[model samples]
Target: MIIVIDGLNRHRFGAVLDEMYRLRARVFGDRLGWDVDIRDGKEIDQFDHLDPAYVVGLDDEGHVVAAVRALQTTGPHMLADVFNAILDGEPPIRSATMWESTRFCVDTKRLGRGRDRHSVSYATCELMIGSLEFARRSGIRDIVTVIDPVMDRVLKRSDNAPYGYVGKTAPMGKVPALAALLDCTQERIGRVRDFAGIAHDVFLTEDAALDLFARGHTSVEIETAAHAASANNDTRPLSALERYFVEQMSAARTSDEVQAVIDLIDALPGTLTPEQKFALKQAPAALAREA
Candidate 1:
């Protein structure tokens, strides 16, 4: 029962807003002792509202749990605005088919407490797949993010490395931090796996990152370089028809609405190639089908 909501509308966005803040506070404030304000048990920053992001996750009853804030390079965001220092004056951040991944998290309590083994980890992977698919459909190919070194190591091992400079070690309360870029390709997408047995503390390192990259994952550097050169320039954004379909899907209020939107997307011309169409149509159904 994973849900993905588009836009920043209050209702959907608000659903997990508090949860996100609480998680961040627990991780950064309480666990790491960051200076984040926890007045109402929420950790929020000024940059949260600048981009169009997605929130994905499951509810308490064995549901998927996830959320992401996506922003393009055209807007005021980390890559172009805040994190420029890390990029070392690289090409002036301008327009590109790039999306930043932000505020991603999974519910800790629901992680390993059920019959489903690695439920939380698998849900996290599913959320990434769904979000990557959505980004591809929306015309984005590069993803930028600041991840925990351990998670960065896992991504590198998974072959999802980015093509840019790794940022200087910053103090995330007590833990270290690094920034990276990732190339979102079908090949890389296929290699995404569950974060099982990842050593939570010892995850980020050049060796670990390379191990992941050697497996076919590109580093953030590669993603950034490709983006800088516009290597995949010919990639197409979603057609107007596809956009309409997604809008309809996002607005769907019932199971019937969901099926109707899926059907309409399936029928749209050029929305997906034949093979991709089969995968897209079957994925959601394989996991949870109704109606």
Candidate 2:
């Protein structure tokens, strides 16, 4: 599912954002050979600090699979700042109704380039639909994105091709990049939705996101998270424990790792609150009953 993280709820999604950054570091720096700064395995740039809106995609298990960043054109966006070369001699297009979309990437290792529900194609199109819908709702009329030629083709195949080009393509890092424009219109959003066979809402609530991450945490980590949650404000969107659980669970790949989480939850009845207990035990209990 897609989650839009901005300055408003950014604090609640620190771990999620961190994973997205690491994914970018892998895609742009390691795989694509981009000249991006990778400090501590995160690809964070100056624009990330400008309170840009991030449309992040998460799988059923709440692991970040794809993401794209959107920044207001009136501000110091990438088109004007980092990728001015793409604009050639023309001045940067700055307007209140326009936004610059960049850092579009997906986890190629996790998702193969197929049309399956879990493939990179589905994730990529879902992100496109989510980002465009988000921009349209936020009163944005257009988006000028700096993307490589491969991505430009992906957009066309997905039926969400850019309406126009802003400037000539320029050599950027290991590949050439150009600025492409997309109008934030319902027609465009509908085409992508049809292409992806996604009729339901693609957005996930913050609470729903928390619940998914809450499912796979190991018992010891659960106890630690529970303790941490107890110290924080009740009104916080997500507690430290939940965040920690998400970080750990996202990395869990083996059956033993999953069983470790299940075993821990099974053993921790006396420690967790009634609400926490219910949330943590419901899924496992249902599966056990079915078995």
Question: Candidate 2's error at 14, in angstroms?
Answer: 0.4
Q: How displaced is residue 139 in candidate 1, in Å? A: 0.6
lDDT for each residue of candidate 1 in 117-199, tens digit (9 for 90 to 100) = 35655556655665666677678887877666766765665455656645464656566556677767766666663333321
- By summed lDDT, which 10 consecutive residues of candidate 1 come out lowest? 197-206
lDDT of 1 at 226: 26
41, model 1: CA deviation in Å?
A: 1.0
lDDT by residue (tens digit), candidate 2, 1-291: 899999998876776888899999999998778889999999999999999999999887767899999999898988888888888889989899999999999998888766877999999999999999999999999999999999999999999999999879998888999999999999999999999998889998876664554453334344444444453325444446545444444444444664566566557666655566444433332122100
TM-score per candidate, in order? 0.57, 0.76
Against the unseen true structure, what C-alpha lDDT does each candidate score?
0.53, 0.79
Best by lDDT: 2
Candidate 2 Cα lDDT to native:
0.79
Model 1: residues with Cα > 4 Å off, grouped in runs: 8-13, 32-37, 59-64, 89-92, 113-118, 163-167, 193-291
CA lDDT for candidate 1: 0.53
| lDDT for position 193 in model 2 | 92
